[model samples]
Structure formats: structure tokens, C-alpha cells
Target chain A: MDEKSTINKDSENIERGNNIEVWEDVVNIKDLLLSILICASAAMGGYLIAPDDPQKPLLYGLVGVVIGFLVSSMIIKPKRTLRFEDEEK
Target chain B: MDLSLIMELIAISIFGAVLYTIIGIAPGTDETAVLMPVTLILVLSGLQPISVLAFFISSIVAKKLTDSIPVAIAGIPGGVLSAPMVEHAMVLKNRGLPDVSIRKMASGSVIGTLIAVPLSLFLANLLIPFGETISKYSNEIFFGGAVFLALMTKNRWLALLSIVPFALLIQGLRHLYWGTGAVPEDTTVFTSFFLGITVGPIILKLLELLNKEIRSNLPRRTTNDIVLKQQEKVKGFPNPFKILDKKETGSAAFSSVLGVFTFFMSPAGMTIFLGEVISSRIKDPIKKATRAISSMDGVTNAAYISGILIPLIAIGAPLSPTALGPGMALFNAPPVFTEDHNLHHILSMGDFIVATVIGAVIAISLTYFVTVKYSQQICTFVFKYIPHEALLGVFLALVIMLAYMDAGLINIGGVILIGLVAGVLHRWGVNYGIQFMVLYAAPWIVGNLVF
Candidate 1:
């Protein structure tokens, strides 16, 4: 009985490792966290290091957000796989 | 006014149109969250006000046109406003007419933009004389709007019950900031709180994932496959009238008028209400669905335009829901635009008209054409390439950065706390419109609360 329960627990762990939905799209939790980390650091880092000029910080932050977005896009593959089907008729 | 300025306006309009068309097709992107950060940045960057107006108008038009693409392509809403059309869009998708659904919706957007622009300008002018009275009672009006929207919600009781507590929570945070000297008493922590509300659901969901029991129990799937039907390419520039039949056009036009009239109401609510009322009598499911989607798209687009335009042209404050949300930057981005000094004060009537015309025309020409011609291809590309992680990352970064900018590090924690509470309220059916109204009326509600 103990052996059987261990096997069941192993199967549940595998299931828990799979993709989960967020904001109407499937995503791996690890990737989500990584992307968030990269982006938050980039954006905040840009904001922090900028000269005290009001516009400079915001502009740098905006650029940082874009950079983070591009980096994340290159690093993380989208969970969705698309398949196309021609019209039968 | 000048040739160089007109040239700059045209260029920015194109930029706005191109940028939003892609963003609009990404599923589940909230209208405000994606639109506001960039707009806020632009405003704070000290760009020309006329140019900003042009960009905003174009962005709205482009976004409205393409947000329905995902609904037609994959049966998921691209934004909150597109959620209402999903049922009807699914109808057409199931009927093997996804392209048709997209074309109809895009055409409907064209009609909406066309009708809404002049009519909104005219209506704004008509109300300009009353702008004084309106701004004087703006706080009371916002409070009343919250109550009215609460009453209209599905869970009216829960929504109504949330108003006072939510108000207290907002004002409580503000008072704390003032007392601790995190910010001056007069410098309201607006932007971060606004971003916090937008990020609420995500924050809640992220926190829930931290619980082992919840994490283990979440339903998981190995493959998240999206099947796209092969669509025949349109050879020429598609005309809006050609895409929509007479009955569809008429209903869309009629709904667009109603959308303008109900400018102060929630666009999503207006879309569902008007879409259903207009299409209820039709017998055929496919026909009914098409009609409904066409008119629904029209209502949202019209409501969006008028929502921003009317309040902007009439009152300098963020009075309407659109103004309060995505268009807030135009009305009240601090140090640049305040309630007292915004587009309404800065731009003349001619400037408004010129900016509106340039933005609307460019967006319609560019986005409408692309939507009819290549919605499937572009949607497939976005789905295949743009990870949800990246989008969510950008959203997260925006909120955190803005929170830090508002009152420093402590305000970040404050924003998250606000997000948690707002997320719970959101999950419980207190809609953004109601929450936003509460945000606007918080100081008033707290100050006027009787012992």
C-alpha cells in the first residue's frame, strides 16, 4: 500500500510540472518567473541609473522594457503550437 | 497648423496604428494595461500634445479593429471589450467562417470610427458650455457613477458592498504616504495604484501559485495546440461596406449612435446590451451571430471614442470610463497633464479636430486593411512567436517601475496590497469600471464619511 501511494505521488508530480494557463494562454511557471525577473530588473535598473531628469528615467525605463521584452521573446518559446488546416471543400 | 507638424502627425499616426494592431491581437491583453504605460511614458517624455492626441486616437482605432481577430481565429478574447463578442465569434468560427467573422467585425469598426468621430466632436462642442457645472460636481458624479455601475453589475450586492471598503483602502494608503512623508500630502499616488488595479488579477494568480496545495491541484495540460483554418487572401483593399451587408451595416450604425449617446457607460456592458437587443430577432444562428458581432464591435469602438473625446473636450478631468482608464494619461499625467491643465486646456477646437481626423483616418486605412487581409497570418505569427511570459513580464515591470516612481520603494508594497484587494474584488464581480470610480471618488468618500 505504501509503494502504491508513492507511485501515485510520482505521477501527480509529473502532472504538476506541465503547462498552466494564465491570461488565456498556457505558460510554464519557471519561464514566467524568469521573464518577470529579467524585465523587472531591466526596467528598474534603467530607472535607477538614469540622470535625475524626469524624461530621461522614463525614456530609459521604456527602452529597458523593450529590451527585456525582446530578450524574453528570444529566450522563452511560446507554449502554443499552431497547426493549419485547409478548407475541406 | 504648420506643414511640418502635419507631417509629424501623419508619421506618428502610422506608428501608433502599426504598434497597436499587433498588441491588439495578443490574447487577453487588457485594453488599459497595454495602452496606458506607453501613453504615460509619451506624455511624461514631453512630446507635443497634438502629436500625443493623434497617437492616442490612432491607437484606439487600431486596437478596436484588431482585438476581435483572436476571437475569430482562436475563440479567445484579445481584450476585455472583445469578451462579449466571443460567444458570437465562436458561432461563426464553428460554422467554418472565421474569416467572415473577422471581416465583419473590422468593417463594423470602420463604421464605428466614421460615425463616432464627427458626432463625438459635435456632442463635445454641445456640452462644452456645461463643462463648468460638470467639473464642479465631478467627484459626486464619479461616486454616483460607481453606484450606478455597481447596481448594473451581475453581482450587484457584492459590488455595492465593495465601494466603501475599497474607498477607505485607497484613501488609507494615501494618508499613510502623506503622514510618513513618503510623498507630499498634495502629491497623490495615482499612476502606480492605477497600474496596480490593472495588474490585480495577475498578482492574485501569481500569489495563489505559491501555495503548494493550489499548485499541485491546478489542472495541467501537455499540449496547448491552436488550430488555424486556412483563409483565402483578399487581393485588393477591402471596402467596409462591401464586407458588411445592409442589415449589418444599419444595425452597426444604429448601435454606434447609441454608443455615442451612452458615452459615460461601460463599453463592454454597452456592447453586450446593444449587441443582444439589436440581434435578438434574427432566426438563423449564423446570421444572428454575424449581426451581433458586427454591431457589438461598433458599439465598443463608438463608446471608446466618445468616452475619451467627450470628457476631454467638455471637462478637463477624467470623467468617462475610457478617460479614467486607458485615456487617463491624456487627461491627468502628473507634472505634464493635471485635471486643471490637459488636452482640453492646451489644444484648441481645430487642433482636436485635426488630430482626431488624422489619427482616425490613418488607423482605419492601415489597420482595417491589414485586418481584412492578413488577420490569420498575423495572429498565427503572434501565437507562434510572442510568449505570454514576455507580455506578462512587460506588464509586471511597468507596474513595479511606476510604483517606485510614485512614492519610492514602500509604495511598491502598497500597490501590491491594493492589487490583492482589488483582485479579490475583481474575481468577485466588482468590475474595473466600479473599482476605477471608487478610485476617483476615494478621497471624497473618505472625507465625507459620516461618523
Candidate 2:
């Protein structure tokens, strides 16, 4: 059946013709620095908001979110490209 | 330990594995969501740390194989870990290798688990001191990780867009759970995480439902084609590792190194980056045979296992969704389990090592046998019996129920609204990951700025 489909079907592959590439880490490292600044600034800001106030839970959660964002950003880099550049025949 | 205690441990392992199997089969759900409720139960049950570790491993390995099934049968993905698998599965499906691909994954899982055992233990030993030293600067390290992710994305707006939404969603859901504490006293962290994962997709699906342009533009569901082109050349014993080359070997090695960085990063993201980089470098002609393709899955499993084990042994960081599931076994083991200095942590380590080896063996061994015997049957069955739209519909409903189960009906409704907003954002070529990052990141930023 696969043979039949391949023969009968258009040679066009769904995944074909697109070239996705990964960015170099040098590029990624920069993004990591920026993300950290944003998150830490955010977290430190949260810590400042309720120095000793109620809603410790919310405050702590805010801190965690900042950390999570910073960490997630650092850990996960963007895809280079979804598909590779297609070569024209 | 008493006989009953041993029996309980066995039960936990079995239960964990079963739950993992379910997670593996289901696309939207992940190990974290699966393990959340289970973790609560373990904490309450007072299970021994070693036994809890065993159960966690069993479930994780089971999911490794099961998760590949959906990606192979349907383009719809399952676990966050399985995203790469989806790409490969699509390739296999076109080539009449869907069953073969699933088997490869299973084989990969087993191989990964086995290889990870000693590798993780060795890495854990190194990470222990490193973790202790880095504890003070964990904040800086994690922050650096975030920035690295943003810049790596290439498009700054796309990166921020993806990162922000996820951060906010996590924070918002966390707040919603906390808010409910005054009312029902039932809201918990497990529910909050579950709500986040479940609601995101459900909201996305709802948007797919609501938007007229999208609804109209949705492609007509394609019928499954089960017949295959017979190829004798494709048959015979193929070395599973035969696909690796110099470039992919490099990525795999990098991924393995990054695996140890869980103290400040997500291994899943690292795997994607490594795979992407390798994919980017491979000039088209060499892409398929690129060692990175094979290594992507291998390194991911390696990284994932290492990520979990390092944290467990080092600073007791339950980082991976799987590790976090059995979190109590590491973080809060009772005095009886560890009367001495952090002996319970060692117990978690031992279990991780053991489970990794066992899971890897099981995944590889079973995948091979299953693929050999039933690949054709399974593919044919999927094509003949399963309706693509029905499968999608089921997934949609599952996502909603999963969210509802986490934070109550109100939270589910909120996620639906969130998903619609996300859908609109997605239309603008913004990324899903960056959005998720934002949702996860926002609360802290907001609090810090306000305070």
C-alpha cells in the first residue's frame, strides 16, 4: 500500500522543501543573559514589594515565576528554523 | 523492611508504570501531569524512598515507549519529550515505517535507560559538589539560562512572546489555586501544574473551534493509508546506532553535558536546541542519515535521566516532570529513611540508577519484539479503524477534563479564554514556547515591579 501511494501520490512530501536550522549557542548565550536580567530584575522586584507583608504565598510564587521564566528561557533555546531552506531544482 | 512494605513498593512501581503507559499513549499529558497526583499520594502514604524511586522509574520507562505511539499514528503529539519523536514518526509514516519508528523509539528508550544508569551515576557524583557550590548563585544561573533561551530563538519578539505567556499562565494558575485555599482547602500544587498543562491545549483547541477563519481554513482530515511498498533493502539487522555521524555525535555529547545542567535549565529545551543545531548544519542531502537524527532521541533520554538523577543526588532537585512526580522520596524522606546525613538522597540515587538500567533494557527489548511482530498490524489497524478527527476530538476533551481536574471548572474556563488569546497570538507567527515562558515568568516580574 505504501508503494501504491508513493507511486500514485504526488511526489510532494509534506515535510519537504522547508529547511529549518538551529541557531548557534553563541547567539543563544546572549539570549540567556538578557532573559536572566529580565527575570532576576522581576524576581528582586517582587521580593521588594512585600518585604514582610502578608500574601507571602503570592510573593514567593512571584519569585518562583521569575525563576521559572529565567530558568526555562536559559534551558530552552528557540528552534533554528522550522524547515531547512529548500534548494530550487 | 517488612513483607507488607515490599508489597507496597511493588504496588507503587506497578501503579506508576501503568500511569506512565497512559501518559505515553496520550499526547497532551506529560510525565509531570501524570506524576502530580501520584506524588501527593506517595507523600501521604509514607512510602519508603527507595520504593518510591522504583515506582517512578517504572512509570517513566513505560511512558517512553507509549508516548511514541500517538506521534507515529497521528501527527498530534503527546509528551513534551516526544516532540522530536513526532518529526521522526511523520517520516516513518510516509515511508511506511510508522511501526518501525515506534519500535525504534521503544528500542531507543531501552537503550537510553540502560546507558543512562552508569552514565547518570557518574555524572551525579560530579554534580554533587558542583550543585553545593552553585546553590548560592542558583538564582544567577537560572536567570542566565532564561536569557540564553531568549537570544537563541533568533526572533526577539517571538522569543519574548513564547516565554511570557507560559510564565503568566503558571503564575496565574498558581494564584488561582492559592485563592481557592480559603474556600475549599483542596487546592494544591499538583492541581495547579495539571491545570496549566491541560488548559493550554484546551484553550488552543477552543480557539480552533471559535475562530471562523481558522475553522474554515482547517484542512480536511486525511484518510490513513495502510498499504506499504515492500522494500527488501530496508529489512535485516540494522545497527540502531548506525545513524550517528561526527556532527550528531557532537550534538549528543553536548546534550549529555547539558543534561547535567538541570540545576539551572530544562533538559527538554536543550535536546530541542541540540537537535535543531544539528538539523540546521546538515546540508539537505545528508539530513536523513544525519547522526543527529538518531542521537537526538538518545541524547534527550540521556539528558532527561541525568537531569533527574543529578538533582536527586546533588541538591535534591526534582527537576524533570518524572523526578518531580516522586519528589517526596527525595526531598522529604522521613527520618527513618535517612537518620544520617542525607542518606535518603542516596537511596533516591540508587533507585534512579537501578530504574534507568531496567527501564532502558525494557524499552529496547520490548520495542524490538513488538515492532517485529506487530508493526504492520498496528499501522493497518490505525488506518482502518481510527478516525483522525475522532482521535483529535478525544484529545480535546481529555485536555479540558485534565485542566478541570486540576483547578476546578472555573480554572478550566479561564484556560479556554487563555487558549483563545494564545491562538490569536499564534496567528501572528509568535511561538508557543515563548508564550509559555511568559506565562511562567510574568507573575514574578509583575510582583517585583509593583513591590
Q: Provide the TM-score for each candidate, comma-separated.
A: 0.86, 0.67
The per-prediction tally of clashing pairs is: 0, 55
Q: Fnat of each prediction?
A: 0.78, 0.00
Regions more than 4 Å wrong, model 1: A1-16, A87-89, B1-5, B22-48, B69-102, B245-247, B272-293, B332-341
Q: List candidate 2 stretches off by more than 4 Å.
A: A1-89, B1-23, B39-43, B130-143, B161-202, B221-239, B242-254, B260-264, B284-293, B319-352, B355-364, B367-373, B421-443
Over the stretch B192-211, how does candidate 1's per-residue lDDT look in tens digits?
A: 78768767877999899899
Q: Give a tens-digit lDDT track for model 2, residues B1-451.
A: 3677556665666676665664466444555545544554564466655665666566666666566676665645656566544565666555555555555555455455556657777877877777666555544444455557666665656655455455555556567767766225543334334334433544464444446676555443212234343323335644444434455445555554555444235445565566676556555533442334345555556655665666677656443433434233445434433323333345655555554455444444444344434545554554443333333333333434445444556755655656666565544544343343343335555455454
Chain A TM value for model 1: 0.76
Winning model by lDDT: 1
